[model samples]
Target: MSDDQAPSTENGGGGDVETVEKSEDHKKLVDFGLDTTVADELEKLFQAKLVTYDDLDPRALEAIRDFPIECAIAVLKQLLADSNLQHVNNKSAYICGVMKTYRQKQSLGEDKPAVTNGPDEKKLKEILDRTGYALEITTGQRKYGGPPPSWDGGPPGNGHECFVGRIPKTVYEDDLIPVFEKFGTIWDLRLMMNPMQGCNRGYAFVTFTTAEAAREAAKQLNNYEIKPNKKLQVNVSIANVRLFVGNIPKNKSREDILEEFKKLTEGLREVIVYAFPDDPKKKNRGFAFLEYDTHKSASGAKRKLASGRIRVWGSEIIVDWADPQDEPDEETMAKVKVLYVRNLRSNVTEEELKKIFEPFGEIERVKKVKDYGFVHYKERDSTLSALEAMNGYKLHEVEINVTLAKPANENKARERRMRRERDNNMNMGYDDYYSSYPPASFGPPPPMMRGRIARGGMRGRGGMMRPPAPMDYYDDYSGYGQGYGYDDYSSYGGCYEDFSAEYSPHPVTPQPPHRGRGRGGHHAPAPVAWTSNAAAAWPPWYAQRSGGYGTAWRGQSWHQ
Candidate 1:
């Protein structure tokens, strides 16, 4: 054996010796002596194991293929003898590590190469595994768990196509068996059947052993019409099924409904127009759900509906608008108003603040309220500007809270209440003084009637017992009688006729309505004019048809 395969004596004599066996792993060397033959053999061995040499191309090593193993081994031994071979081999090993990493990365399919040619079975599995795609295995039934009626039990992994259609299950299984078996092993086959219908519905599911066989079956059978009395359509078993039944005419049967939608969509996967079990008599439930195997066919159905494909029976089919996810916008009108701010330092007056916000907008009105200690702005924008500028600015050791002003009506109501309270206080004080005791000129009651006797004595002793009257009294000066019941003015030289006229002993004649008017009744007609006008026009009618009549003509005549 060569040194490469030499037995080591590192282990002691044969007493269950502990041996240091040399690792046979390949190593890198900076210098390798010439031995092309052995190097080629090593390269082939690594290639067979799917190991790559980073520094050397696998294609380049192909030239040494015809060389004998003995010759290759000789070349490898010669290369290993060189001192610098170790360094070159180390470089090669480093490159190989990087290439191995890249190959592992490729397996992950991060940047997958396009698969133009159909991938084989193994490649399909690898792709599916990498992409988390499922085979989507399914049995022949509308819902799950119901088996095909004519189930001629087949093995697992049969190379056959599966689809959902309206053709009878008996016909689908009988016709599809021979045709699908042409490509490869038909491991499993099923024709989808409605349990209640008890017949094939023209749809089936099939599986094949090999992916290539399935692909071949799909390509050859798709759109190929087989006429067994009526033409039967075939297509690939695409999984993009959109099953929805809406907007069905109330008067359509299962067969009639399928026929209508079959004409509508080219690749009609399914068209079921059955009413609910509870209401079998009801017409079609007013809608039908359809399932299409391909997006193209579903979109085609939508296009057909758009082009007036609706048929009316008891009621016309309708496609409802989808409800929006977001609520509709509400519109509002903006209002502008004056704002009065309070709780400001009295030193920070109105004019100074108005100047601060003057650049932002027009300053309509600004006034300081020292009473309540606030600055009021009539303009909306000025208030906004002042808020924005001085909102965070420290004023009177506090940041100002600025916003739009409250309603002026509210402020006015508050002020009116305050003024009303002040007026009420003044009225209360005046009433108290006015309601007290009467003045001295009104006189006290006489000594109280208990002394009624003294009151009688005072009353009976009149003019003779009384002292002479003072000169201030001119009662007898008039020529009236001066007896006990008469006026004292008659005792003087004064005439009683003048006194009687002044006193008005005779009933006075009533005064006529005033011709000299004041603001009180200035608009009223004069007494003479009122009498004349009333007599002429009371309840009068128009003299001419076009002229004014009685009360209907007020301030101005209709003719005028």
Candidate 2:
């Protein structure tokens, strides 16, 4: 056939494109000489709609595709440079391990940056120097800073650091250093970066050689515009040297993490990984705090890892300066001025609790529950002062312990108690029976049930509550005690406020009488028997001792 008459390769766009891609994929699969079972299974899964897929996404279709050999070699060398690969024996094992890690990352639906297609180290450095961004993007963050060529070796003096905020994430050190240096020589200028997005976190810390320079920078650069319609917030700030390392493999132990990081970076002093108290395997929370010997070392490591050039444990790791969380955050402290005061003398009173904490701040409210109580302050600063002073202050011959009332626990507990209280109130049939009785005089409750009458919202022993099942919600603090009256509070002594307290402390609210109590009021005279359908003028002795609900026991008719 004439060339013009021949079927065009592009005659069917999708068919031709798919055929070419399949051919290329086949070639790639054949060249790698690796198993295609993973790819095949995924394809089958997609066909059956058992798993999600993006047909247009290359990773979805080529999940098991081979990488460029050159890129693979470069990565292997980098890994070897950072770690001892003795765990891996031969080329086959290495390749399998690498592919397995890659597959696992892909399975997590991570969008892999084109490490091979991106600029090389030199080109990347040039680009970072020019545009302040890296071509190879991944999750986590980075930091970049260096000390000025000054003489003093001591740390930045008090008030020598200023926080620069509201910065455009697009602007980096290349643009910021020159502008800030105009004030004075910078001791250290660290810009926080979000590597996943290849941008700043809109804040940085600029430390000057002298406190005067720091003040000058804050005065001049405060509200200075770095980008159109954006002003920087420059104010004195405290400096930190710890880093937050995220995206760590959950299986890695503290020892594994510390050892790996020590080799990759200098001056790594400690690795802090927190495990859930309830975790059986004690896996890390997929992140850790790394304390470096010096801020310089921490900054250097951040810069290196931020370059998108290295991976830890064959996985992308994120790094950023750690935010201090040993205490309540400012926002939380602002809202909750309540202090958790414990370790009090048994003789301590509500007045004593108030008197003790009132010296630090204006007292808002105070409630003494046995050996411990909570004092609410009108201001956070006052709460802080009280917290610091009274944490171990001696009161009544006992070292009083105090801390910020963690509203999270208190709030959660209050909610549960309120719910449990509602349930208990809803289940009390005898209270309804007593509250809805008529004006006709009823002799006191049956003689045998007299002293056994459950007090504090309990009428006929039905209000007897139980502690939360240990297997369900484990807690380290006392439970929220329910009753509010001083008499009840004193007797209960914050029992419900503490989980370990022996008494069940559900405070009952006066709910509308149950519908079964067809006629009811809040304060009605007690009657011996229900006018509508009394179970018995007097129940047998055994019936009063072991009563049951739903049959004249829980505000229901015995006949029904």
Each candidate structure's TM-score, on Cα atoms with residue i matched to residue i, is: 0.17, 0.29
Each prediction's Cα lDDT score? 0.34, 0.47
Q: Model 1 — which ten-residue stretch has the worst lDDT? A: 526-535
Q: Can you write out model 1's per-residue Cα lDDT over 288-359, one digit (the tens) per residue? A: 545554444655665666455465443334331110011111110023333333334547766666666567
lDDT per residue as tens, model 2, 1-560: 54322322222225643111122333344444523333333333333433333321444223234654433433333333332222222334333444445445456775342122111345436534653422222222223334443345655633567778787766765567668778876766666554333356677777777767877788798889887898887866534446766668778888998999888888777776544323426456566767675557777988887667889988777565542211223454456567766555567788878876778879977766434577868888898788778777877555555666544334435544444445446655535544543333212222233332222132221222322212122232233221111111111111123343333444333433321111111211111110111011111122221111111221111110
Q: Give per-residue lDDT, candidate 2, residue 522.
A: 21
Q: Compare the candidates by lDDT and give the number of the best one.
A: 2
**Judged by lDDT against the true structure, how good is candidate 2?**
0.47
- Candidate 2, which segments miss by more than 4 Å at Cα? 1-170, 178-187, 192-223, 230-342, 345-347, 354-393, 401-560
